[model samples]
Target: MIIYTPPKPAESIPLIDLGPSFSEDLAARKAVAWEIHKTARDTGFFYIANHGVPQTLMDGQLDLAREFFDLPLEEKIKVDASRSSCTRGYETPGLQTLDDGSPPDLKEGFLIGVDLDDDHPYVKDGVPNCGANQWPEQPENFRTRYEAYVDEMFRVGRHLMGLIALSLELPEDYFAQGLKEPLFNSRLLKYGPQPVDAAFNQIGAGAHTDWGMITLLLQDDVGGLEVENAAGEWISAPPIPGTFIINLGEMVRLLTNGLYHANMHRVLNNHSGRNRYSVPTFFDPNYFYEVRCAPTCMPENGKPDYPATTVGGHIAEMYRKTYGLAA
Candidate 1:
């Protein structure tokens, strides 16, 4: 059956008051969590206000990200992604993509996973980011600030995950088990508008969903991001002041047995003369964690599309496709 598509702006963006509601009242928290559920199931992405993150810190992170992006190519390459199996270094614009059989994405990213030692459980046995970050010694404060921000993002991300668990009526800290030493990633992304004369120009980032459970995004005002809704309409997600855009990802869909969704999204770059920067925190469960159809997700009448599966095994299959991991 054909579905009626909603217009782009039809997506509802609820500004949650995180101060008293999220902290004090049980019903308040559930109400906020339900909002997340509705938005995730209906559209897959939403902007959050009153999220409690400081605008000053957000600005500080953006300035640092842009500064890194503006550095000379050679300097930035000191931590190139090719050096690691996880693709955790600087990506030149057009090096990666998720478009439907299209060319690579036209954006650069500096990727990092959770900070941990060599013995972290998530990093063991053919997983990425089991070691310390490769820092650029030339920029003295770069490592310091970058690490701090990523850490904060991880803390906040896990907190939100707990709320999601509560909304689902699962264990309050369902994410805690897999996240004891979570395999989270924070990317400093830059979107540069291309020159008209340039021969092979394209959009900033191709349509794709996060591989992790969820993504917390911070973007400057110049917006180009869009997500597809249940009605198959593409909704533009513009940048809002002091707010973070949250998106459901593959892992969450898997964990919830499709109760949540991993939405399709893309970035378009007009010939407008502007540069945009965004930072996103990607919270992935431990590489080996089994992501499956929760028992609570099934019922007497309806069975699952697939059998219960481990999170690690599923992610491994995806890695094989993306990074050529051994079967």
Candidate 2:
């Protein structure tokens, strides 16, 4: 296994530009990869600028999300996540507890994945997280804007997969094969201000590491997201206009044999009486794809920490733990 080295001190998160050139020129792409590699090894979190996602698209998503979350409790419950065949519906506050033994998170969420019908090949084959999406009828333009945003994020996610492969010193397209028919999960989250008394244990979200390969997040100007540095100090990852926050997840850390840090992070509810909104798209490979240590990540004269496991199983177990469905 690769050894872990603690960061010397906390520093402001870096903002990198991932423009069209990143995917256009091979040499430049590798240079970019080296930069990402260093950042991943240190913090696994960075802000990406010039990502090509339109400002209007981002605005549309946030607008639609606010509209959905503002609906009456009864209206929101109509699409409750508990009703989904696959986790593709609305989740009320306190439904997820990311930090084991701590109070549940004080945020509401709406999760959507690769939208597929019952007749789709994957769904027909009984693959998990490949069912139809739950829709809200009140917002006339929600479906259109939401789907458009998801499609764009999916494109960016796929592009980042190649960059990550290059960063790991593997063939740039090494992850391409695995991502064929990949499972992409996106969540729209709303964190409202909580009273000081209720905020003791009811954090906006609890400290935890993400379970997927990578996550691309879009957050509004109202800041609250925090990431723990190697030195154990929590640092702010506030909103950066025209950029998306990207972070490596547990799957990547495991695949890299711990060379990369999948740092712990948590969110705080706004106390200014305003709400915080974020959209996080989880880019994961096909459910059945087995991940193992990459060649460059194997420790000298040693083996990987563990054998390969299906990405789906690893993610599902974490889901169970967070949702209190684990036995």
Candidate 3:
């Protein structure tokens, strides 16, 4: 698990077309894998185009997000995350602090995970974060639309994971084996525009690396997302119609022995008068699955920079710190 940081990060993220992988031609699939390999190692961030997800469905998610945020503060708090044992439901602004000394993020969000029933084995077993969703009654179709989108996104994520496996020179199904009952989640966020005189640190999100395998983000036209380069410069990642921004996470970096980049990133306060909306889906392995450096990714020395840990444990520790629950 040798760590190899790039000397300089790319100024622009690679735009990859996944259409080739769907073909039966082996060469086409290999070509896609090569492209993914380069961009993943260079920046750990890229734009995916020609993905199977319908544009209409993507638009529908944004509509639902705006509508949900428009509800009165009282209605939004009805299913607040504080009421749930897992990380689901509405999250108020200034509640999540990404950096130790940075001001709480100036954004509001809603989190959703695999919708399980009380009778589900995980819920029955008292698994952390395996609870039913709390849907608001007013937005009658909100739950349905969100769940539909989640299913579609999950499908795409699994497909990408297979491609990632191929890129790593492993069997295509390698990751699928550990993804049974994955610990994934999706978030709907709204960042209000900041005042001209707002403090420099009043950001929508502070600099931090994602804790899971990967993240797929769909952003609105109003841009604010920025990725930090190796030189520590912030690169703006504006919204690109019909494209989802994909980035590797810490888990991928750990598993790849640092062949992939889990680059740090943050969001600036929305400067546009209209609220900025985004949907980011996190893809992870099963909660109890143990992760380690892959044989193909390890160097000759075979020394791991990170120790082995369960997916659930990694997430719990991150949550404890971010939520101020850690001593």
Every model's TM-score:
0.87, 0.93, 0.94
Question: Which pairs of residues collide in model 1?
Answer: 289-311, 290-310, 290-311, 291-310, 291-311
User: Per model, how many backbone clashes are there?
Assistant: 5, 0, 0
Q: Which ten contiguous residues of candidate 2 have the minimum total lDDT?
A: 16-25
Residue range 1-327, candidate 3, lDDT tens digits: 979974566898889999998888877888898899998887789999988999999999998999999999999999998887776799999889897788788889999887788898888998766777778775767888898998888788988998998899988889887776667889999999986766568789888999899899999999999998666778988899999999998888889988898998888876668889999999888888888998898778878887878787788788888887641
**Candidates sorted on TM-score, descending:** 3, 2, 1
Assess the local accuracy of residue 185 in candidate 2 as a C-alpha lDDT between 0 and 100. Answer: 84
Error of 1 at 232 (Å): 0.9
Pick the winner on TM-score between candidates 1 and 2.
2
lDDT (C-alpha) at residue 232 in model 2: 76
lDDT of 2 by residue, 1-327 (tens): 979986476477888778743567798888877878888887789999998899999988888889999899889888898888776789998999999889999999999887888898878987655589998786787778788998888788888888889998899889887787787788999999876778456799999999989999999999899998767788999898989999989999889998888999999998889999999999889888989998888888768886788888888788778887741
Name the lDDT of candidate 1.
0.73
RMSD, one per candidate, in order = 3.7, 3.5, 3.7
By how many angstroms RMSD does model 2 differ from the true structure? 3.5
Over 27-92, each residue of candidate 1 has an lDDT whose tens digit, in order, gives 777777777776666676877777666777889899988888888999989889777655667877
